[model samples]
Every structure is written in structure tokens, then in C-alpha cells.
Target: MTGPVVRKCPLCGKPRSAEHAPFCSTRCKDRDLMRWLDDGYALPGPPALDEEEGKA
Candidate 1:
């Protein structure tokens, strides 16, 4: 029989660490956080309207 599947880190493709769960290490985890904090990731959506335009 085959063994349980091992998930890799999304950042470096390394085997995931239990402590970090999805990421392999604190560095990768922090990098992901930085991406979010820096607005490196975004979701698909309609463009936001300006305050002046919305007020009209």
C-alpha cells in the first residue's frame, strides 16, 4: 500500500513542516505574510470607484 500523501510548501516546494503547517519554515511563512501586508496578492473583482464619483 502507498503511504499518506505529503504536502509541499507553496513557497519553496519543500515538504511542509508540522509547526508551520502549510509552509516549510518561519521564513516562508513570514514571506507569505509580507506579501499580504504589501498587497502582493489580490482577488478578482470590479474596480473600486473613487469617493467623489461614488458621492455623485
Candidate 2:
């Protein structure tokens, strides 16, 4: 029989904790937050138009 599938933490590859869900601990969770706050993650999009260009 096969055992239940284990999910590893996205940050440290550690087993995920029920409390943290996707992360293994608060540290990893906080790190992921920091990455977001610091613009470490971004979505695909075209360049934004500048205010000057719109004014022209």
C-alpha cells in the first residue's frame, strides 16, 4: 500500500507543518512575506505607461 503524499516546504524543503500549511515554520513564512514586500516576486505584464507619456 502507498503512504500519504508528503508536501515539502517551498522555502527550505522541510516537511510542512499543519500550523504553517505551505511553510515549515514561521521563519520560512516570514521570509516569503519579506520577498513579496521587497518585490522579489512579480507577475508577467507589459511595461507601464509613464504619466508624461499619457499627458502628451
Candidate 3:
């Protein structure tokens, strides 16, 4: 019988480790970090106005 849905690693479909949490291994973890550093992820929203620029 199915008990519950087990959470899988987002980087790869593998069992998650206690240390890595969401990622399967350090490599996947590092890869995810690199993606963020390279602006691989972003949020959609209107651009915020610069308060200082408004004063000028």
C-alpha cells in the first residue's frame, strides 16, 4: 500500500541525503548554487523605483 509521497531531489531523481537536504549530492548542490550565481533563476515582478533617483 502507498503510504505517502516521498520528497525527491530537485536536481536529480534520487534519494535525498540528510546533509544535502533537497539536493542528492554536493555536486548537485554546487550546480544549483552556480545557477543562482549565473542568474539562472529569477523572480517575475515590476521593476522597483529608485527613491534616490526620484529625488534627482
Candidate 4:
């Protein structure tokens, strides 16, 4: 099956067009940058659930 459609910019929920396939506009793209600078996004790690730890 074909992969899911590419997403638009997170800051502005708009369809990805040819001019800005990923981001609707430069402003939206920059907004994502601001979020990174402000540490607004975080990559969650997997929970530590080892079998050995449970045994203890």
C-alpha cells in the first residue's frame, strides 16, 4: 500500500501544497523552530520494564 500522505506544518493545520509541501508557509515552518528553541517538543523514551527488575 502507498505510504500515508505527507503532513503539513504542525503550527498551522493546512493541506501541504506544492509551494510548501511540508509547511503551509515560512511562518509555520519558523513556528516549529520556535517550539524547538523553547523545548516545547520532547521525544518520549520507552518505559523501563525489564523482566529481571520484576523478579527482584
- Global Cα lDDT for candidate 1: 0.97
TM-score of every model?
A: 0.86, 0.86, 0.71, 0.53
Better of 1 and 3 by TM-score: 1
Local accuracy of candidate 1 as per-residue lDDT tens digits, 12-34: 99999999989999999999999
| lDDT, candidate 2, 1-56, per-residue tens | 99999999999999999999899999999999999999999999998899989885
Per model, state how many residue pairs clash. Answer: 0, 0, 0, 0
| Ten contiguous residues with the weakest lDDT in model 1 | 47-56
Residue pairs clashing, model 2: none
**Candidates' lDDT values, in order?**
0.97, 0.97, 0.88, 0.77
| Model 3 Cα lDDT, one tens digit per residue, 9-55 | 89887978879988889998999999999999989998878998778
lDDT tens digits, residue span 1-56, model 4: 99888776656778766685578887777788899899898889987788988895
Runs in model 4 with CA error above 4 Å? Answer: 1-7, 46-56
Candidate 2: residue 40 Cα off by (Å)? 0.1
Q: Is candidate 1 or candidate 4 better by lDDT?
A: 1
Query: What are the RMSD figures for all models against the true structure?
Result: 1.2, 1.3, 2.9, 8.3
Model 3 lDDT vs. the true structure?
0.88
Tell how far residue 24 is off in model 4, in angstroms. Answer: 0.4
